[model samples]
Target chain A: MSFFDRFFGKEKKKSAGVAKDRLMIAIAADRENSRIPNLDQMRAEIISVLEKYISIDEIEISKERKGDMDMLEIEVVVKSTG
Target chain B: MGIVFAVISGKGGVGKTTTSANLAIGTAMEGKKTVVVDFDIGQRNLDMILGLENRVVYDITHIMDGEANLSQALIKDKKNENLYFLAASQTKDKSVLERDKVKHLIDDLKENFDYIFLDSPAGIEGGFEHTIHYADNVIVVVNPEVSSIRDADRVIGLVDAKSHKAKAGETVGKFLLINRIDPELIEKNEMIATDDILDILSVTLLGKVPEDKRVIDASNTGKPVILHKESEAGKAYRRISKRLCGEDVPFEDVENAPSKGIMGKIKGLFK
Candidate 1:
């Protein structure tokens, strides 16, 4: 406001928006494509492993994704005790 | 754990109400008791979304004004037994709610429900301040367009300023929900992708809901798409609900994903 007022008769500040497409894209990938395997995948893997025996109740497992040190984990309750 | 989330957008019709309505239903479908309260006083469509339009005899405004108790205003869901609705007032008056009264009402609801979802009024007006003042968490909905993202940023700032946690020098647990994303448009490099939106907001990516016809149909019937069991948006909302419950949900690669906008878009348009 000071410089504009002195030089150009009170010209207002017009903010030229910084295009954030590049930054937003990376953040979205990190979030949506979280490399850390999630719980749903873990549940599917657990079910496949338990296929020989029986269904199980909420299995608790946690794992971290490799990239950007992100992590994804889930807990699922299966009906059977097997 | 009882979670309180207020869904807000700087602008209206970007699905704040839709997301609030469906997110609550999705959470209930996951076996959590959930309720969505309308704070968008004059324009109340959440009841219509939950198909409780014909059932509401009271609203949060009533509780705020001491005209009704919270229990009396809590409407049972027509579909999900665990879901509930608190309709907004049809009157344009925003003076009915006092800040402390709204907070007290929310604290009381927390004692009974696992989650309380508030559908905020469009933009950061007077009502927007009250909507975010007591939020334990906030989900800012954006449509992947410039105007929407710009408004989302403004609301995110307001959220940081007014949140109870923020007042104690902590920021609200802010997340971004991008709705009506079209994979085909992203493949054509015409629309902003998940990454693009995330980069701008610098927030935790909740989920990206693809544009689908089922969404319109679900709203028409006052039933959430998550109840459908097979629709794409329903699947996304279910995942979003689960993620909100602190479940580990995997991300499915959208058909038009791997969208790199800046480097590519700049080159294509200029070169």
Candidate 2:
């Protein structure tokens, strides 16, 4: 709700959920049958956005497909500044 | 044998029993008399997952060993009148289950239930085969990651070769359910993208579940995700259930569950 709330990490749970939800749908929608061009688009967009802000550390992409549906888990922890 | 459907995974922790338990509940909720038999003998977590641990006395092993009858061993959900459960023996070795005995047991169950859901063990060998051998369809549970996907791919092959349908010169109708997706990580290229999994597994995707902590809470509380209104996993599972019943339904976007908000949280919180 406020700067204090952000600094204290109270809103972290809620906001993290919101942000994760938005990011997942965008990636899923972009994926063609969850195949290739979509993943390439997702990777490019993520890399560009991260380069704009936090210093990139490492990026690993993994995926799982069920029948005709797809699910992805993305773990991103930024590199610390000195 | 009864129309068996095994909810399997190559690796553990991708929600195999979770899916099987809920699908049992969901199938019963739809008025189909269903029984979810926990075949993960010795592990015995299915009862906890279904919230029926305390009531299980006459387990499947008791019936298989001729110590108890099928009806005597089956535990009714009590909450859903149409649902029943047969727990695995907590003390017996998994070797207690023989292929012929299992076939006979499942055959008796098939005569009684419209759907027989088997919560299979993690591997393809031993009890997993005996459990999977009677299935009409197989739902492969996989998380969107390297280890999980690779294992699921292997398990899919195993199911194809090991299923009863395979013996009849037909492959089991395999469907994939990808679980524990995180949208934020995908946006950062930190996690696997949906596309990569499909490229490797090469199976038809049934549905995708978002990484929702509500699932853990629900599982802990002994309720399935489908029971929660606000759960992305719950809602996704409901959609998957409908698809299994041949109903037309759209899949949930794995990334859009959080903003949809409060309702999912409240639903889980109340449960």
Question: What DockQ results do all the predictions give, each relative to the true complex?
Answer: 0.05, 0.02
lDDT of each: 0.78, 0.78
Structural similarity to truth (TM-score) of each candidate? 0.73, 0.71
Residue-wise lDDT of candidate 1 within A1-82, one digit each (tens)? Answer: 4442435473543221223544354444544543344545766787788756766665755555576785546565668543
Model 1 lDDT tens row, B151-231: 787678667657887879876889898998888876755677677677677788888888879988998887778778878
How many steric overlaps does candidate 2 have?
Answer: 18
**Clash number for each model:** 13, 18
lDDT for residue B232 in candidate 2, whole number 0-100: 80
Residue B154, candidate 2: Cα error in Å is 1.2
Given the true complex, what DockQ would model 2 score?
Answer: 0.02
**Candidate 2, residue B271: how far the Cα is off, in Å:** 45
Report how far residue B7 has shifted in candidate 2, in Å.
0.9
